[model samples]
Target: MKKIIFVDSTQIGLFTFQAYILELCNLNVGFGIYIETFDIPLVLFEKDASDVVRLSIDESLVQFIANKSISSRIERQQYFNQLLEFVKSSEELAAKIVFKEKEMEYLADSKYLVQMRNIYINSGNQA
Candidate 1:
């Protein structure tokens, strides 16, 4: 398993540092979840290893990905490619890109599901 650190802006204030632990669920695509406090995952490609792939998760699939298993590496790559194409091809999605949140089922039913959900629900503060 890979450990990625994320700095949550909402959690940072005055002088409080808290480490919220999140569990990894088998996406089954060989790709593990690298999400932090934020819903989006910072996907780094194998090529340059510097390029970050941003995923625009669909709302309908949020709970599904949260409840499903992970996927393989190749499957992840394919899914990523497909998402990229989807975003590029859809004018409605592309227009409101910044307003959408990304969601996937890779780390769905992990041991930390409850905790993760709690944190997300409490910290999200979204309408």
Candidate 2:
């Protein structure tokens, strides 16, 4: 069966908290993360077997779901719909970092965020 791990990005000690999501996300699974009202889909590996992503993250109200297998397109859409409500009521700080809807302008379109994920994972693993 697939697993679901929700990350709490709003908590203190980023590197420490990241370890959970990082470890699970590296297992070639369907890892996903959602913070506050911010919703961004994170995939550990893009493959046909992506399902039940064993996520390592903090627990929060706006829960991010990761499937273990390739879910139907329709099902995925429904999942998104359900998430909207939970995300809408989430905290603002985490929402800014998770969603691409922010108007920060500075790091808005920057690809470094993806890079930062890698860096965070790499560094956390070493510590």
Candidate 3:
């Protein structure tokens, strides 16, 4: 049996995520993970066992479904269909989550905002 993992790239703290994914692909590890990117079909990899361990990622969607050894092609197709429906329904929610994360990153990286935050903290203590 194989394993699968999901990674949301729209979120921060993923600096080494791409490198990690490539490493897994190069090493032909049975474990697989998928990450969503702004691009279509964001990232891809192959497994040695010919397992249908495929990944599909996009701006608001990150999904990876490893075909079970016991399952038939039709079953795999059903899994893909379900995943597509889930992505379609969750687009709005995913977009909101990604946007909020980016907004937080923007605020955290702003030196001016940091200085202002520090000033506010200091002034409150002086009261």
| lDDT, candidate 2, at 80 | 42
CA shift at 71, candidate 1, in angstroms? 2.5
lDDT of 3 by residue, 1-127 (tens): 2223333322212211221223343445322223333222322323334443333233222221231123344544443344434433333333243222221212123343334323222321131
lDDT against the true structure, per candidate, is 0.29, 0.31, 0.31
What does candidate 2 score in Cα RMSD to the true structure?
Answer: 17.1
Please say which candidate is ahead in lDDT: 1 or 3.
Answer: 3
TM-score of each: 0.23, 0.23, 0.26
**lDDT tens digits, residues 7-90, model 1?**
221111111221212233432111212233434332221111232222222332334332332544444344434433332333
lDDT score, residue 12, model 1?
A: 16
Candidate rank order under TM-score:
3, 1, 2
Off by over 4 Å in 2: 1-69, 92-127
Best by TM-score: 3
After TM-score superposition, the amount by which residue 110's alpha carbon in candidate 3 deviates from its true location, in angstroms, is 32
lDDT, model 3, position 35: 35
Task: For candidate 2, report its TM-score.
Answer: 0.23
